[model samples]
Target: MPPSESATRLPPGPDTAVTLGIDPETLETLTYLQREYGDMVGMTKPSGRLTYFINDPAEVRRILVRRHVRYQKGPGFERVKMLLGNGLIVSDGDAWRRSRTMIQPAFKVQNVHRLIGVMIGCSDRRAVAWAAAAERGDTVNITEETNEFALELILISIFGDDYENRFMKEGDNPFAFLSKDSTRDLSVVMKVRALRNLVLEIIEERRSRNEESLDFLSMYMRATDKNGEPFSDEELLDEVMTLVVAGFETSANTLNWVWYVISGHPDIEQSLIDEAGRWVPTVDAVTAENLTEMRYTQQVLEETLRLYPPVWLFTRRSIEEDELEQYDVPPGTDIYLSPYILHRSEHIWPNANDFDPDRFALVEGKPRKDRPYFPFSLGPRRCLGEYFSFLEMKVHLGLLLPRFRMQRVEDDDPGLELAINLRSKRDILLKPSVR
Candidate 1:
């Protein structure tokens, strides 16, 4: 079969070379392409690699779920690989499969249930700090506050006792830089290397003691493959680093946006508070069951993710020929799917730019499959920490929102910063007052 005849022709795109990297300009270019060229626009990179911007819902689901095996993690991950090594986020093929299998057991709902106390504890710390800030009438930087809360929660979940006794005492937290610094320069790489070595040291110490514990590290240490093999030290280090980076960033960014969005919509904020009070009336009442009962909070989080998905852009490369809707995706073609673009597309979602949690409201005997929302993504490769992150966010919001009311310090919108993670360009400050 000849190259042109065997596959359907590519969709229409601009003749100008498009440089699709992790930057704001790339997002603007993508938005323009989608607007001008319709849903499935095709382009050639300056290097002559074929690229497709898939905004159609059916096609997006087909690429991510049904035909996932025909693709691999594509470009733009070279920078991520520097930080995460070949962990689950950047790893593909048998390596990803093997690592995912070993790590899946550790994230089971039962296992995650054990971490609720830790979530409450992290939220309580935030409450105490915010209470003091409210007393002093100071504006709270919700961005940095969410970052620290998520960082502390994940660290405790991953390290347990060592989070305090070992990791903290090393002066400043080596992992804290991952949250603060978004740039993936040489300096960031060096810091990642240092953090990796620190994690490796912890692994070695844990192995030496050979005692059983309940943290992620302990479970991962005990997890064995179908062949009864454990992850090598380097492999374990990469996986741990992946967990920390993946676990912390998404929840923190979403919560930061939640506060900003909630402040603008007082009616929605009161609904969340009422829902939280009904479910979790007191700190002692916080539990996995109670948190799950706060259905309105979940909807609010879902709507937030729909608007500000942390991973705004995702790229993959087709390793083999595939058919998506009417278009034929030729082998070696690069794929671009932007949740941020698709979520806000006026065609797919009516009034898509509006912040409406009711879009996710549950109706009796109604199904939600038709919605084109996948903030944590879909398919087997979907994030394993999705459940954990949701629990953490819910606990933080459900417990904290009831006691404190936050007013946006500034009326102007905090514009988006399109990077590897979608975040507010400036720190969002809010005035917290006791309710």
Candidate 2:
């Protein structure tokens, strides 16, 4: 079949050339395309590659879950590759498969459960800081607080004792740049290279010790392929960097929004407080079982993610010809899917812009699985840290919300910064008072 015939079958989009890059404006561009061309829109990029912005639920699921093998991690990942190297998030084909398999065990529920004490400790550290701020009448920068909290948690989780004894002894955390600096320019690239060397030092020290440890670094070092071969030093560094970047940023961003959202809604805030008081009245009482019982907090986090998924935009390149619903995807086509756009689409979710946690509430007997919700994404490529992040967030809110009440320092919305990760354009500030 000729390309024209296939093109005709694809959904209609503007004939004029469109430039889509991974930036804030890409959201507006995609929204414009969806509004003008409907659910499945096709256009030609400046590179002359055919691109499709797919919103149809079944087609989205098909590409992400069913026919994932036919596609590879596509455009916009070059920037991520600079920082992550061949990590699981940016790598494709056999490389991704092997790394995912080797690292999967470290994220198992039991393994994550072992880190709950660390989660509580991290949250308590924040509590102490916030209490001092409360006494001093200082406004808490929730954005920075969450960033530091998550960074500390993931570092301790990954490096264990070395996080305190080894990594911190270097004076300032070298990995702090990942959160403080968002721009992916050449300077960020240089910093990433420098961080890799720091990680290599830690790996070398661990290798020389030759003792077993419970941290993720030790686990990854021990994890072997099906043939019983371990990851090369370079490969291990890539995976470590990927974990640090992936594990912390998403949870931090979500908690930052959660604090902002809860500050405004008193009824929701009170309900969450009540739940936390009942389930986790004290930090010492926090356990895996009670944390799971804080169901309302989970809904709040879910709704927050629906509004601001950290990885808001995703891209894939079709390696072979494939058929989508009512369209033929030719080979070498670039695919774009936006969880932020789809989660807020009015056609799929009524009153999609509203911050209603009840939309996720169980009805009749089951949760609303039919709704298009993929904050962490879907399929085998779905985030491995999903379980860990949830537990961490729950612990933070459960212990913290009960003890302290926060008021939004600024009444205006912080607005969105749709970069590689979806974040607030301005840092969210809140005034904290002891409850």
Candidate 3:
């Protein structure tokens, strides 16, 4: 299909502007624009540059799928670059293509399945702590709990034994700062610099050891470009930090939101418990094959992610002229496509605000899959840790939910914290008691 007759010309309107950041106010801004201008809305930035918010499913699909090569990661990623450098999540062009090819195999289902033991180990730590809290008749701070669980899991999955012997065994988790310090300011920047140095030391030690290992670190160390050259010390640091940041935050936010939702809806919590009991009856049964079989557990996680997708808003900039069903897009026009908004859009999802797990029940030729449900994003740039995250989340909730029940300490809704990820502004406090 080609451009429509009107697609040759830009849509006519006053370029109303809106600033969309990963913050609470941006949500209201996006909603207002959609209501006023429909799916495709034109706006001007403070710099007087024109940007478009495309809420149309087909148009969004075209930009991310068929015409992906004509765009790069835009807007908010500039701040991410300070953290990730030119890593796969931020890099584009042949640099991205090369890195994606070399690192793709490490995320294979079989390779990811190998990390299940690590996931179980991490969740066990949480179980120990939560059980202690339950015994004391104390409230479990699930917000911080999931953050530590996820950060520790990814660190171990990436660094293996080094996570304990090096980072955590020194009386405190060095990476704990990531959770406590939300600001991406100079202080946080310095901390990230220190982390990079630690990673470099580890990389050097691994290189000097001259032995084959199977963790993500070793896999990345062994990855090479088209010329059969490995990543330099600097390039390796970029990717390692990217993995640590990207892998941990998203999963943590999802787990935090899961606890919130589960606390509010006892019926769903009971269903999850039953499902967890049937699938993961014991620690030994919490294996990759078993996680896959927990279809109901998967649905619960899907529902949670649908309600609170971590990467809430995605931005792209066109590098070439393009046309959608009803409008023309000139080269260099910034585009905003949000799964957060679309998932909750009443037009796409009926009763969009409701938390109904039945909506995800698998059906023959289910049409929901065709809709925009991209928590891990879509197309080639989708998160590499997607499968790993789901497996880890399932293991965490499955192993724990059946053993302990959490009651919400407060009746008020835990509102959103719109940072790089959608997090709970306040810590979710739950009274943990044995089931």
Candidate 4:
């Protein structure tokens, strides 16, 4: 039986029905509501649907981790569904569980560790470009560069040889639009669907060849559920598209922010360069232990994620009635969790807006409850690529920062885009000079 809505005390909120979305206006509304009403603000939307903006870290943790089964992927993901289909990020219930179980093995530590050469290869590709720009005294469009670096890295990682022999023909990658356009509009969705057709063709080609490769596609193709059933062609395509989008954007956005921030803080950049010097002094020296031992670099990335989580907002819908703190969450209620808002909450973090990496210094090996942070989110449903993401970014900075010095062009602030993924509104320009 579900808890009765009438039986519990509702949290404070505005009397008039409010509107919410995955936009700046929606962010403003949530922030204003948090300020006006406090941590848990319950409100009726214009559609008369019940919604709660949950800022209380404990309660947010409970809903996302402990009581997660009572919820389904919610409202905002409709936008994503157009792009990714029913892959892991937007799926719910048994479908999600099955996909997650099958796909989990593909992201295992040993598997990710094998891809170090690919990571370095991608960085090397960027190095060549940055070096050219430096020789010509050009300012690099950092936003575009990170986008290319991450997008190319993910493509090559997924498709292996086909990325060059197939997609990179005609001097243009077929998947370039994905990096160039942030707007996931109808046309973009159509392009993604078309790309899935390309993926479908590749799957068929691989199936016919019965060949193995060291890439995500090969791993995903080999994954099986408990029943030993491989993913269906449709399922394979959805997961492939999911992997493509999910694999790239987080790293791209984070790297963009990382470069932008480091340029503004030379001391931090020098600290990162110094750390890279000791652990990853040369390309050949980068090892599993080296990545793990780069403590200061890790702190810098953690602090950057705190200020600007790639996916700034997360939304979910309650399946069954539930309780969060003193409030009763009735079935069919919408739930909102914003890492952007919570990470910057003044109460929990003193001088929260400041870019200080020391706050995360004490967070190493700490208990789950001790930290109120979730840049990649919490619990079982948390991002599968968390470890892989950190390593990729580390390799990117560790290798490149020591060889080149980059500072913001004209010292301009690249304000945030703040859409589905938090990105710089303006393409951040950086003047690069080889060290």
Candidate 5:
């Protein structure tokens, strides 16, 4: 049967004259399109290429799942490739499929649960320094704190004993530049080169030892492709760097926002503290089951992601002709979807601009999957770190919230930076006091 008449036409959308190499601008464009042209919008870029903005959840799912092969990682990926090489996040087709399968086992719930000791150890470091700062009545740079926390945790998780014995031997964290600098320019390139050298030296040392190590590096080193071939040195480096970048920034940003939100709403903050205290009574109580039972804490993190998703905007290319409910997407058409816009779309979320964790509670016969929500994205290529991230976040808040009251230092909101990852435009400052 022929497609519906509406599906034969592209919905009206913004002109390319508007984009400014910024994600928030792209999100603004998407919001305006959804308002002006409904859920499905279409337009022609300045280069005269067709594009579509798909907001329907089901269609979004179908495209990412059953039909993913028809497309490749599209526009805006060049910038990511500059940083990640051809890591899983940027690679497509067989390469992506192969890498994802080989690496999926390492992130299984059991494997992630094994990392809890590291989580506790890292949070204790934060607790010690934070307690000292609270005693001095000092305002804490929670932004930097979360960044360092996530960076250190991911390093320890990835390197195990070597994190303390090797990386710390320099007496300074070598991975500090990633959190301090925002620009992905020449300076960032040089810094990444240095990081690569460090990783390469470690990889070689591990190979020379000929002994088994049970960390992520060991797992990736042993992961072989379908041809029974290990990842090339280049591929291994890209994947490791990808993990370092992805594992830290998103979790850190979520925590930074979580602290801001918790500070503003004392009642909700108290609830989180109570829940954490009740469920996670001690370091011993921080098991996988205990972390999973921190339901309210999970809601808080979800709501925070809705407000500030790390990868706020995603761009893809429609490789084959496709028809949406109200738009005809042609082959080679560029497509832009914004989770930041969809999360705040009032038609789907009432009082969408407000912070409310109650919206996440599971109602009888109601499910959040039905909503237009995709903070970690949707479909097959969705983030591999989604479950791991939430787990780490729950552990962090669960361990810390019970003992400290976090107060926002600034009256004004920290606006969005909207780069590769969503970051606060200003440093988020908060004061921590023992409760």
Candidate 6:
């Protein structure tokens, strides 16, 4: 790769050059960089922007955890900005700080615990649909099944009664395309922005009636900065959009792969079902205490995330001068981190290609103390919904896996689609039977 314009004492890299457009295109390029040069690889993007790929686990932590304040979100977020607007995912600096502070309370463990009922409700809905499919001896599109499960769960969690009274009453979910459509191009962005009117209307009615409820929408509406001012209508709309997209996609993709993995690993699937049987035998029994005891299920989810992190390749930019090892990172340098890469690196994970949940087994009531994993990124910018997503996945698997058994329609590999999110290139089909 060409020495970056600002390249000074940057790490050694080949001048063979690499083009980064996102996906395997980017993945392939980065992998080559790691193979040709050791952990920290630096190069100039074709756009003349200096870029550094940090696969060194310790350095990755330092950039993401210790000195995170010195860097802000970097390249490849332009399309994301169109979808999320100035919401938490796309905003930086004071805007991000204010939004995170205001929205953090809504994800408190106590708050997420209250949504257990909603998680079960959505999983039960999937059970109902799967039951009908099983009776008919029909092939189930588990990709669609998980997508609907997560989409419905997030909507109900956010809107509560409004999900039924408002969104359902209007016919199909206006945001359903998010699950069905994979491309995050202009068409999708336009569709996402158009929902602003629907969200804005909801906000307006809530303001008019002084509505209050135990749901994300209400919490977001009431969220105030240290100044004690609530989100403006536009800011509130962006937040709602961000919530829907955030809550829907990653979890859906995870549940999609969870089913695929379990289908392939019957032994692991049996363990998960047995764990669920012991811990969360029924909907009413899904207490936070019981779910916490479901460590094996958490392992399954973590392994799946390791294999296919949704937001696979992410970027950040340095805001101030920083040092990594002996190298100097000038301001405006772009940095890339990939959990997908790290999670599967042979040096980092033994037999990295294997699907093994045992690797994540809890030790003495905690995750193995030093496992280098960050499927949810790290530090303050770590996904707030980490707890919520895990519970949601565990609940889905706990309830559904016990009630139904699925066999992959064909034993062919469902290749990967590595775009903004890493997904199975083709919809995974399975024949289901009631357990």
lDDT of 2 by residue, 347-400 (tens): 999999999999888788667788888888889899999999999999999989
> Per model, how many backbone clashes are there?
0, 0, 0, 0, 0, 2
lDDT of 2 at 90: 96
Question: Local distance difference test, per candidate?
Answer: 0.90, 0.90, 0.85, 0.90, 0.83, 0.89
Q: Candidate 3: where are CA atoms >4 Å away? A: 1-8, 12-14, 365-367
**Model 1, span 69-182: residue lDDT tens:** 999988888889987899999999999999999999999999999999999999999999999999999989999999999999999999999999887797888788877776
**What TM-score do all the candidates reach, one by one?**
0.97, 0.97, 0.96, 0.97, 0.95, 0.98
Clashing pairs in 1: none
Superposition error at 50 for model 4 (Å): 0.3
| Candidate 3 lDDT trough over 10 residues, lowest sum | 1-10
TM-score of 4: 0.97
Measured over all alpha carbons after superposition, the RMSD of each candidate to the real structure, in angstroms, is 2.0, 1.7, 2.8, 2.3, 3.0, 1.3
The residue ranges of model 5 lying beyond 4 angstroms of the native Cα positions read 1-8, 14-20, 364-367
Candidate 6 weakest ten by summed lDDT:
1-10
Question: Scored by Cα lDDT, where does model 1 land?
Answer: 0.90
Q: List the residue pairs that clash in candidate 4.
A: none
| TM-score: model 3 vs. ground truth | 0.96
On residues 1-435, what C-alpha lDDT tens digit does candidate 3 reach at each position?
A: 111234356543335455667677878888887887788877767665567788888888888888998888888888888877888889998988988998999999999988888998988998899899999999988988999999999999899988888987788988898876667766787889999988999999988998778899999999998899998888888999999999999999999999999888989988988888888999889888888888877888888888899998999988888887767777887888888899899999899999988888888835357667888777888889989999999999999888888999898988888877888888899999887
